[model samples]
Target: MSFRNLAAAFALTCVAVPALAQTPAPATTAHSASDMGLKMADTATVKLKFVTVKPADITSSKLIGTNVYNNNKETVGEIEDLVIENGKTVTGVIVSVGGFLGLGERYVVLDPSTISVSNKDNKWAAYVDTDKDTLNKAPTFDYSKKK
Candidate 1:
């Protein structure tokens, strides 16, 4: 080869060698599954239970904002929310009483047993034994305090 070509090749090899050597290697982690925020469960020891939804079952979606009626079929209050205990049991049902377009509204928590929810012709209805006047006279639920 020519002298000029030989000197150029030598200069290129010297510059490329240092650049290739400076490249970083892939990193390895020593963390386990739990350390990496993954929950590891033993299938042999864990027992999984499943729930079956029947046609007669009433879901929370049908309860919320549903109008509650008295024994006379008069609208007493509207269900605003539900209070569940221990993440499974529903202990109370919050209903809004004496409200007009959501103004001057008062909330009352009633026992789940006092309210009977039924579904007929795809329409859900909630029935209570008390009248509208009695519900308005009942104790009001305060949002600020935890009870």
Candidate 2:
């Protein structure tokens, strides 16, 4: 064969070999239980149960925005955020205190255990053992600064 023809054949072979060696992906279709020889259980076999909680139980949404009071029955601040540990338990709460209309407000971190909830005058009240003065002086928690 001529050198030019041989080189042309070799280049075509190299390009076509890789394209011919590739296997096409298998086509997929929507499947049902019967398609795999599986049977669906009867509705009667399924049981639905409702989770019950006491009225005093504190939910995450309820905990947030709830007013936090001190031992002196003074409003310290409201809960701005909750710190959950391992997605199961609450470890602490971020309290917004010492600010007017959120201008000078600073967040303070306190343990969830240190707060208590009570039913007073048909309303849920949250109380922290520390006073506003102490909370205002506590170290501020910044959400922007993350570890």
Candidate 3:
């Protein structure tokens, strides 16, 4: 296992979990460390189970415009659009952040893997893992492939 995975394993072990995490996380469908870093694999080697929370479940559901926060609770960007790659998995999230009132709304791509369902009170929130500057510095994508 790589250092990142080792650290994650250690961190997870350190946490007060009610149960132990299944070994190798049952072969996650999400991208592996190699894929996340190198963008090597475009398809999953395993099937993972997940439940998609509906739009109504999001706390910012009816807001029309809601901000996305990072793991540290810092505003990363506003979720203006969503993009899925390869006709299946959600790959990139188009965020419109910074600038004043749409004058300079930048289209930044937040990796889908970096996001998780923010378990808010009776609702869901999209939380990205990286901070604002790091988010802004991420690579841009050509989102012509609309799925």
lDDT by residue for model 1 over 8-91, one digit each (tens)? 333322223323332232376343323221123554432332233445445566777788999899988888776654333456
lDDT of 2 by residue, 1-147 (tens): 443333333332222332333232236744333322112455433233223344434455555567888888888998766664432334567789988887798999898678887767857678988877799899988863242
* Candidate 3: tens digits of C-alpha lDDT, residues 1-147: 444333332332322123433435335555443332112357864454333333433322321145788888877677655443432344556677666777755777767567665555744456776777776666654433232
Which residue pairs of candidate 2 clash? Answer: none
Worst 10 residues of 2 by lDDT: 31-40
Cα-based RMSD of the predictions, in order?
26.5, 25.6, 11.8
Provide the overall lDDT of each model, using Cα atoms, as 2-decimal numbers.
Answer: 0.64, 0.61, 0.50
| Regions more than 4 Å wrong, model 1 | 1-48, 144-147
For TM-score, candidate 2 versus 3, the one ahead is: 2
Cα distance off (Å), candidate 2, residue 43: 25
TM-score of 2: 0.59
Question: Highest lDDT, which number?
Answer: 1
